[model samples]
Target: MKNYKFIYVLIGLTFFLSSCEEWLQVEPRQSIDSATALSSQEAITAATNGVYARFRSVALYGRDFLAIPELLADNAFNTGAGNRLVGQFNNQPGSHMGNWGTAYFTINQINLILRALQEVELPVEFRNRIRGEVLFLRALLYHDLARVYAYDPTADIPGVNVGGVPIVTQGTLTVAEVEYPARNTVDEVYTFIYNDLEESLGLMQNFNMNRRPFFVTRGAVAALFSRVALYRGDYARAIEMSEIAMASGVANFPADPVSGWRTQVQPESFFEIVFTTQDNIGANESLRATFMSRVFLNDAVAASHGNVVFTDELAAAFPDEDLRRDLIQRGLAVNSGVFEINKFASKNGVPNLDNVPVIRYSEAITNKAEAHYHLGQFDLALTELNKLRVRAGLEALEGITGPQILDEILLEKRREFAFEGHRFFDLKRLGRDIIKPTGNVEHSDFRILANIPNREIETNPSLVQNRGY
Candidate 1:
């Protein structure tokens, strides 16, 4: 499997230390200065590409980004085989560091692009579209950050008092420049993300592009709206946005949910970052492959050092008739018999798959179902979930009331999106406690939001650490 190389330049500690000197001494490669870089159509487009490029970085959407969070949260466990880093994540404090580091890395890139975009000149249509993409990306990045770094707003943390990652809307300055800002309340962060998505939806409404799986589209905006609405507990808006995205005809699931899952960059995907085999973006070398047991038919050599397997609880959630059980879960032959692992990615020998979906249409439908159930529209919720069941080669659920149907819908999401990086956030947002990992050395502190890395904390004094970190 080829490892995808990200094109985006990370503004890491090295950059933060040098920013002052570099900003004073060097002229940017494009245009006269950073300010001028966004003044033209070409520069603005490149800036957009730069922001998109971060999706492929190892820390963000790249290998470790999604993998670490899922692994730490209990959706998947590490085989304790391959990398030392994987084991570290299974431990405490370390997991939070990895999560925070990657998220901020991506956030900094978005901030840089947004600052630059403010000065660019382009047609109204072009500007709106570009701005829309920026806003959407910003919202997506912050949403993930919030989930990883804070407690549930409705429960542990007061909506107005909960602290989240610092709002770095502008690029960083210096180490001394690090000013400590108390954590903005969780509601503030969600409001920021929601406002950004709303702006993106409005800006992108008339903008159309070629059907490129790698880029954001109007459909992507709607899909994001559904997600944001869900987080905000706005069931009606969630249902409306999800339905709108689905009605756009963008999020189709394959006849075989298993095969459909293996193809991460399918046509039904709303927005994804494209990867190529030639570019060393190993599609087969993904986080999903790292968890498969040796016995699975499609297992790859690169993933031979298996890490995590599916919990029996997660595996049993699938009905006997659901093909996804066979597609997603497999038994590994060991001296003790067999262990189950998730098989979302097949070993295609191509190092890089063309795309990794950030948002999909099916997610919209699931979001709609969840919202409907919460809104007391039980029949409507089940009806929406059945759409997924029909595609997955399973019988539609029957004879269940509103609350009962909601439980079914939640379980289905857990089964369907298992190991796809949805479980942890779902657990957090729904105010459900994770099934603690037994016998792990660092078990008790697993649920506490990880602290932002020491480097970030040192440089940005204003950034407050999460409680109990």
Candidate 2:
């Protein structure tokens, strides 16, 4: 923890870290000024803000992880030329699958804060709240890494010994500690992630943790556990956790569902990573730069910079009556003919400064619906799904009960989360083939799993690359 630690102090959300240049390098410990930073409740809070800053970078939720998954799946269409994110899929996996660096950097910051909180003499509530939030963030990052970089534990062909990302609990202080660490098995990493989240739940009870979407509250922790359980195929646990989360008031839809997408912090959001003008990833190269073009909507200041566009399939499949369809815009791409996708458009009239939702009420409901369908509670599953349908301004279906209901729930999930980065992982969890029109992908295709970044494999010879990369 000392090695990755820095004097990260926040003055009104602007973090000033000491020795920032070597934050991500492989070297021995330089004694961190842990005393100064962990000395008070306020300083520790500042350190936690630094972790949020790490999350807001381009590599994590700020851009690549949030936007690229849709491109990898059928949610977005390639613009035929000069769309580099589209170009990434055509490029080799070894180079394009590059989420390792930013993810670990965020994880490292969380670990440092966790370690610092251990000895700090803060009030009990503050200490526990800080600890719980850091633990939740840590689990969240590891979950994404395992899902994207490793084979799912439930993958049919996998044995118990399949590789996952390295399980780094505490931050490393020396080159020898993590420079050559081998990958953990998929089960081991998942176990590690669950342990952190479970512990976080205990520490977070009734503590709203700022009572806002930016921090993961006790209810959000429950929602996250429900999500993890559903994805991990623990259907019974997911159902139970989803009930707890809903009873905790975490699954209630926003009062204004249509405006929720463009609201800075949607009311339905359980946990979000916020961006401000001070820390905004700018217009030229952030999410707005890659997804939408700003124009013609009577808002020129927040015009879109187009990259990926909605597929004709997505546009047609998303029912016109659904308010979500309004989020999609009909516009021309710089590279292709007229197309549409406004899911990532600016919310506050500034390009690329929109907040990113990590977990939301609709997802909690999605988890509940899926879990119920898996457990043969077909009526309950349909009821949960109908809530989302009605919220989207669609009429609820009647008498659709039985195993076939899973398809309904899945389709609802796709329509609800179209560009919010759920498509690829959802297909993986279902063990289904990805079928895009004029698409060559099939079931059991090795490329569905991306390869380890070549640079990572080069640095650590012990790491195993994914199949057929």
Candidate 3:
């Protein structure tokens, strides 16, 4: 294991130095005093916008979380064929420093904003809206961190108060806060997330949600709450919150692939991290760079530097008539037939300008369906699954009963949200092995969770590495 100091000093220096390839469009911002920056309404707004810019950084949604989960599971394959790191995550998962460090660093930025906002003199409506948005984003970040780093609170692990990353909410104002923070329990983290989302909802309710899909809204809070509840096994709450979200009229499953998965945000996306021509994270490291064929990303060639694409096993999982098949590119002559993940290809005819979807409406229906199935309401579960299927013009699921309904629901989710970061979490939450569609994983192996970055443990003696790492 490597023992390196946190170069956060350098990180702080480069925090505002945006290159042309970066996806977020924000003005250059250097570090400023929390009190001084927060004193003005304009400064508070910029600080809040800075949170989104940091969230979209390369280590966060820019690549690791959005694309790597698909690589970790079976939704997408590293075209490098074990030559590089995605293969390592699939074959034998280990320390994911990019995801771990970036998550906390992003969290620190949010905390700074929160602390600053407390003393700022802003209009009540504007203040509520900004604070609510930050809270929603904070909840979302913690939820993902818990998913990757810590064991589930409901897992059969034998420890009380033992399943979380460190709970660092407020900015580092004291030595005790920064140097000696202990990990919170998974239950505590979930509690924190739930409370944050609830507060976000209450605050956001005061404002009209006329913002773009890139920004958080009341619907996003409800949607995230539904997901958190589902993860925590609160089936009734999941159903309730999901229904509330579905009623918000922001998300839907458009039957076609071009709009359903291709267009970043239509009626279907509750929240998306947007990229524009002025802010595209250039060709090499973009989602389009990794997923689509080179020709699709920039018309470079038929196959230049083909990185990540759909495995044939994944392709066969979808039925012939499903529009989701369009999410996977086909009909190319290379390799007997070329197949690529075409979901994130350039939409506005500009390379790498695709918006990353964070929350969508179809998830609420499926989440509610799973909750219903878990609560033994099999008919209701099947009804919800049919809602999604019928939207895509697929035949309704009938004759499904008992545990098969759960299996069908999961399969439907795999079809719907593959390459969008749900496969690994779903499998882990359901207590299934990480067997891929291609039958490549080690059987009965429990290496589902990512290892805590070695540097973190070395720096903080209190931090515990995951078992069997």
Candidate 4:
């Protein structure tokens, strides 16, 4: 807690500024004096925009969240082109999602904004909207932290189930204000997330704002709730929230799968991180560069490493005539024999620039499908599953029962979200072993949970490292 002075120091500075356009266009980072304060709506709005900017970080959605999960699971492989993601591809110990510090940093910012919201005077509508936004963001960060740092409630090992990440709601600004908190129970963390979502929804009801897809909305909150409930194995709640989210109609299945990926805003996105031309992370760090050789879908030359390629198992999952198969193309001549994913290939029509979808309608449908399967509603499950299967040019199942329905749901989820970062967590939450080309990593493997930061353990005596770290 004491070691991360940089995040603490950012408490008062307007570190990032963005204009309120139709899209949230985050400006370049610049540090102002620490005396800057969130005393007014304008200041708080700027601070909130800064928090959203953190999602674009390489540590979060910009790259690692999308790439590392594929590498850690069986869906992707490292081509050894740029010497990147090879360790993750091999399932090496300690080579996992390392966003603990970055997440906490953003969480603290949200905490501060939440605190200030009560004090700073504003119209009830504006204040409620902002509060709803920050609360949703906070829940999202904690959920990500818990999923990575601890076992899911449904899959916790008997003797080896450590606790989830620390639950920090209060803001920390100074050394005297910092608290060395211990891990909370996994159930406690999920309960906290549920509470936050409930309150956020309460605050946002009938409060209409047009920040769809890019900014958090009531629909986005419901969509995320569906995911959280599904991960927690709360089947009934998952179905309820998925229906609420679907009803809001923030996003939906696109008319054309291939054309949808080329659009600036994802038709399926409930919440997406918008990356403007000025914010392009370039060939070195962008998802487009890491996954595909060509900057544009039609380009013939190589642009970046094209380091992460599809695994044979994943490639074989798609049928030859599937529309989704068109999302992959042959790599540059240098890496000729391989095929690369083009899902993130310049959707913005600019090299290395694409919006990252954090939550979407497809997830909600699959979540409902899986939840229904678990609750013994096979017909209802197949109804939701077939939507995606038919959309992807695969034949729908006529008759399936028991575990077979679950198998198809999981398989469809894997195929639909192959490279978009759900592979590893999906298997983990269900207590299933990760089938990798390197070897099968059992559910009980200690590496299933990432190691807490060494510095965090050393500084915060109350902090407990995961077993086998």
Candidate 3, residue 295: Cα displacement in angstroms equals 3.7
Best TM-score among the predictions, by candidate number: 4
Whole-model lDDT per candidate:
0.63, 0.71, 0.72, 0.84
Tell me which of candidates 1 and 3 scores higher on TM-score.
3
Model 2, position 233, has a per-residue lDDT of 81
Task: Name model 1 segments beyond 4 Å from true.
Answer: 1-36, 83-91, 159-162, 172-180, 262-264, 278-285, 293-303, 329-349, 352-354, 436-446
Model 1 is weakest, by summed lDDT over 10 consecutive residues, at 1-10
lDDT score at residue 329, model 4, on the 0-100 scale:
79
The runs of at least 3 residues in candidate 3 whose Cα sits more than 4 Å from the true structure, single-residue gaps closed, are 1-35, 81-84, 95-97, 154-156, 159-162, 173-177, 255-257, 262-264, 297-300, 331-338, 437-446
List the lowest-lDDT window of 10 residues for candidate 4. Answer: 17-26
lDDT of 4 by residue, 216-258 (tens): 8888999999999998999999999999888887787776567
Tens digit of lDDT per residue, candidate 1, span 403-459?
688678877877777656676667667766566464333222434566666655555
Misplaced by over 4 Å in model 4 are 1-36, 207-209
Candidate 2 accuracy as TM-score: 0.87
1 or 4, which is superior by lDDT?
A: 4
Error of 1 at 236 (Å): 1.3
TM-score for predicted model 1 compared with the true structure: 0.82
lDDT of 2 by residue, 1-469 (tens): 3232221112211222343322321124332353364455655676676676677777778777766777777777756433467644443344334567677766767776777678766788888888898898888888888877776766644642248889877754334444456899878888898898899989989776447878778888888898888878888888877777777764357754567876667777778888878677776556766676663233444344566677777777777688877777666435335456665666767756788888878888889998888888888899999999898889997888886788888888888887778887888767777777645555477766667776666666677777775
